[model samples]
Target chain A: MSRALLEVHGISVVFGGLRAVDDVSFEIHDREILGLLGPNGAGKTTCFNAISGVYPPTLGDILLDGARTNGAPPHGMARLGVGRTFQIVRPFSGLSVRENVIVALGGPRYRGNLLRSLTSWRKKGIADEAGAILDRVGLLDVADRTSGQLPIGSLRRVEIARALALSPRLLLLDESFSGLRSTEIAQIEELIRSIREDGVSVLLIEHNMKVAMGLSDRVVVLDHGRKLAEGKPSEVASNQAVIEAYLGRGERGNVA
Target chain B: MDYFATVATLIVIQAIAACGLNVIVGYAGQISLGHAAFFGIGAYASAMLTTKAGLTFWQALPAALLITMLLGFLLGLPSLRVREDFLAITTIGINFIVEAVFIYTPFFGGALGIGGIPRVVVMGGRLGNNQFLALCLVFLVLSLALCRQFARAWAGLACFAVREDETAASSMGISPVRAKLSAFVLGTGMAGLAGTLYAHYARFISAGDFGFPVSISIMSMVVLGGMGTLFGPLLGAMIIGILPEIFRPLIDYRMFIYSVLLLLMIRFQPGGLLGDSSLVVGLLKSLKKLVKPKNIANPREIGGDGDV
Candidate 1:
């Protein structure tokens, strides 16, 4: 097995009196595709938030390449090579599709120094880089269109393109398949496979069981803020606890 | 000609300041209701340095700009903790506090403003009204170029990203706090530049000159011209700055008409006159259609408008 790229060591996130994620732990090896599955409100996104540095976990540590990085700011996490897509897609709506990707492409360089950013004449290089990423995600055709006017499928691709611009070692995709047509879903799955082939690890939160099962090498199921099952896709699908957590105990007794 | 030149000079100066404000309000998506405070600071800094410290106008200009920018940085620090309406309210408070400081501080002349500000001496003689207008025109051009550069550069893109979605921007490796701070510092520094020019040109200064009303007027220029676009604020300043002089015959009703016009603009064209969906764009599009050949089709139309 490849060395672990990310290790979530018993993290808990509390919101007021509610423990959104409680003592949940998992690991993703380098070049691995790990599916994070849960029912609605099962703390999957909360876990993503914690790992991506949106908020610090109330307890435990998140090690990225063996370095403790629990409470770093989101941009700091991105600088550390952690890219992410939101559940509801966010594109710089007023900007062109190419410009949205360009913003992400130039983020790290321009975020710190104002004078260098203002005087820099790297427009041609950045535009070429953005075009390459957009072409990778098959959005090169409508690269000049305003992002706000794009449909759901294209918007999702834009989000992915923006994330890819970060050159992340770990990609966190939150519900990228939701609201996409089957054809789009297949295209996205192909893209994810290619991303893994490029040696980038992926942590995907997916509700489409078949796609998730086929795509991920390992699957971790979360039920009520706890890790219910973590193993190979086939093994976790057949686990009795996971079945009960999904279908409830009264209906699926002894079925697996 | 003299009246026209003076009005034009004031319009150009206001436009420079409005362009600065647009960097914050239009591009970066932050509100600053206390911009006049920075302007006042610049004016007073230049005034005190030249009058009391016996420094040349050239020497004081850079000092005033740096002082205003440093204060702008301090002002931007609090913006990270507050957002939107709260940020607007905090800026309003800053305006009031700064005004109080100006009115009460002994060094700032305590309500009786400093006077006898030295004029820009080119070679041997002081600049005339016409020459001064020419100088202001040059600054206006520089301000516009600066704004254009910012809009196209990496920092500008970061500002737009932060404006669109802060969380999404951060996840993409852009720091929201830094983006906001840069906007604030640049915007306030521009306002200070305008203030410096105003003090020297008018050869007088006062707290009432940089009051809340002046702040509102600058904001209205940006909003009326179209907030985010390059030429919008300039157009806004020209119209707003000249309207009072145009309506001088009915001076009492001038403000009423101005208020009515702004109300109508907000109601009918919230995007301002130069925004993407503004009337100007619509008119230009129709004009293009009218001038185009009837037989030839637009390539973009053949491509089905680039929609899904």
Candidate 2:
């Protein structure tokens, strides 16, 4: 495997008295798809939040390409090539889908510059580039549609497309497959594979086991804010600790 | 014709100010109830500079804008931490404090206000009211064009994104502070410019002219006009500014009627006059249905209108 693109070492997140994520560590290599799997309240989203800089870790280090970035703001993280999607999709609802992508495209580079923002219209090929990105995510048809009116499936694609606009090295998707139908999941799974092929590493928090296991190169399981197991999909899925935590003690014996 | 020109002048001035406030409150989603304070600052700054500092009207205009923008940046600093309701309260406090200073401080002429301000001297001659009205119209045109450029630019997009969701905006690499500050500066600066014009045109000013009520009226113009739309504030200013002349008999109940109108607007049409979801659209749709039931029944016709 290539040198780690993202490394979370001994990270812990505490909210009030509760330790939402405790002493979690993981590595995501270049051009890799790593699945972060856990049941509800198992710290999956919390871990994604910490890595994406939404919630800074209370303990340990987050290294992106070997630079320590524990408490960098989310925009700073984006500049460092970290992109994320919300669990509940956040589309700039008032804007057109294309405008939403354009905002993300210009964000890390052109923010706070009145002159650049003004001349951004004449910038060569921005619209075409935004259009190409929308096409890649299969949202070209709805490029001009108001983002607020888009259905959940299209909104999910918009979120991913917006993330892709960052040209991120590491994409943290919080439940990208959640609430998606099996057919839609298959389509997004294909898109994720294509993204990996394009050299973007992905760290996905997924609840859909079939899609997660099928798509991930490797898997890490979290149980009650702690790492339960980690390995290849088959190995991690067969781990007794993971089965017990996910299936409960009474139903553990029936795990496939 | 004279009366018409005077009313047009007021509308144009109010529209310029409303456009400025629209950036802060309408686009950036920051509530500022004290915009009139910046307007006063411009007026007073121009008055003080022209009379006290011995500068020309044109020179004082830019100077007043610069001063107001500096003040806006200072005001925007506290906004980096506070948001929404708290920010609104802070601005209201600023308005009251500035008004108090203008009313009580002898330097600002206390209740008597500033007077003897010279008329706008255009091309080495004092401009008549009509010519002055033309100047305001030119400024209004320029401001509207600048605002349109802003709305079409990435800066405006960033503001909209921040207003919608700060966290999402940040994740996309847009800084909320920078976006909000830009909006605040631009908005307040425009208000200051309007104040400069108001001072030179009115040729007499008092703190009463730019008190809390003026701020409320300005905000109402933006709200009633359409918060983020390019023509919304202009439309709103015209309606608010002219309504008084049209209903001169009930002039005493003017503010009361406006308050009730605002209440109705918020309850039924929060988007305001030119907002996408404005009551005007609803009324148009109903009127369309009344005119041509066939068009109302045809989804394709609705789609065609949307395309347009």
Candidate 1: true contacts recovered, fraction: 0.78
**Where is the poorest 10-residue window by lDDT in model 1 chain A?**
A247-256
DockQ of each candidate's interface versus the true one? 0.67, 0.68
Model 1: chain A TM-score against the true structure: 0.96
lDDT of 2 at B149: 83
**Tens-place lDDT digits, model 1, residues A66-126:** 9999989999999999999999998899999998998878866665676778854344678
- lDDT per model vs. reference: 0.90, 0.90
**TM-score for each model:** 0.96, 0.94
- lDDT string for model 2 (B272-295, tens) is 887977767789989998887663
Q: Superposing all C-alpha atoms, what RMSD in Å does each candidate have to the true structure?
A: 2.9, 3.7
**Model 2 lDDT, residue B263, Cα:** 99
